[model samples]
Target: MTTAIDDPRRTGYAAEVVANTLLDLARAEGRQLTQMQVHKLVFIAHGFTLALLGRPLMYNTVHAWKNGPVVRRLWQHWGERGTRPIDAPLPVSAGEPDVGSDAEAMEVIRSVWNAYGGMDGVELSRLTHTRGSPWSQVYGQSADLIPNEITREYYTGLARSA
Candidate 1:
């Protein structure tokens, strides 16, 4: 069956653009990127997107979990210990923010990376699962089957791409 990972809008346009931006960012910072490196970069972008949207990390975590055991372990470990945002109010804005802009979204990605030491996908996923205390509150329940499907489709795509 097709999965969210198979959706071009999700895994192709949005995810790929973010991944490329991250790769460029890492290179600008003098970091070398491997295939897995690209994978991690994309993962971080996905996580940052969720955080900025005020959405739970469920989908992102599930995506990471499908990547590999390393990802799953990362989620399990970091999701348990991550820090959370304290209740606070945002200043009233005159209009809705442009959530679809890449430049704006990239800022959030950079912020998350800076706050977490620019960890790779595997490490970041692990950290998020373990150290992202706020995330845990939202990730109270696990969705086992969904993640498996996501992971399967992702790997299958990778294989086809290879």
Candidate 2:
């Protein structure tokens, strides 16, 4: 009886899997992801994946939080680590399965990690908070779903220009 709705650990989506992968990447670099770092990186990963694959990397919602893009769920877990430097890293598994068949999404995540992982939290936040950025467009709104369209278009343009 492994119903999709009933399985809290596996939602048949790539979010947790991607989180695990990103955390592993963070660990390798001796970086402890702050809440902002976790959110921005995950959002960027989704943006690149949506740009390349026409689908979101994570099944979770991306919100234009006051700071920047945020995944509320992952935010909480990382938030618990507080604003202190060298906060404990989230577990690699974090109770979710690997992204079984979504290698393309993983590649995008890896690309994002490689390109942006070295950046500081403030820098990542600034990138996402840029004027005309999706987060800027919905900075204070309640229904802050970071638009898939904007994300795709922006990241696609970035990829092309890069």
Candidate 3:
């Protein structure tokens, strides 16, 4: 039985689907990304999706960690890679529904890649850590979750300004 979390129409694509798509884009450009870079890119793309399209990008939870916004599932899945560039795609686990079918989502990921793909993880982290950024607002506070509403509002402001 598929729940709302697993249904792309209800929530969003699986984080791995998003991550794998990002990795694929990087590979096509002859680039690579550390786990940190992957996480940040995913979060950034998600934020933009929420703001611009008024929809979520991934079902995964994003937490304001010390480094920056992090998708917890991605953190654990790619943690073993450390600072090394991830060279391969994430294999879809058994029983997991195949996704990445949303054209709008793919376009958003592609746009994010074209915009921020060149920067390394450190640079991306610095961008997300900037004052008034979604991560900056809730980080170090009693709460950890970087609410989607906050992300949408912040990114919406950014879009309007840009």
The top-ranked prediction according to TM-score is 3
Scored by lDDT, model 2 comes in at 0.73
lDDT of 1 by residue, 22-131 (tens): 55566677764444444454454444444343332223333323332223423332343323321222222243222235454656667655654355545654643543
- Superposed Cα deviation of residue 149, candidate 2 (Å): 2.0
Tell me the lDDT of candidate 1.
0.41
Better of 1 and 2 by TM-score: 2
TM-score per candidate: 0.42, 0.79, 0.90
- Residue 150 lDDT in model 1? 37
Candidate No. with top lDDT: 3
What tens digits encode model 2's per-residue C-alpha lDDT throughout 23-136?
778888777666667778888888887778777676788888777788877876656555555445445454455664467766888889989998888999999998877788
RMSD values, in order shown: 15.8, 4.0, 2.2
Off by over 4 Å in 2: 1-14, 85-96
Question: Per-residue lDDT for 74-158 in model 3, tens only?
Answer: 8877776768888788876665544466777778888899999999989999999989999999999998999999999999999
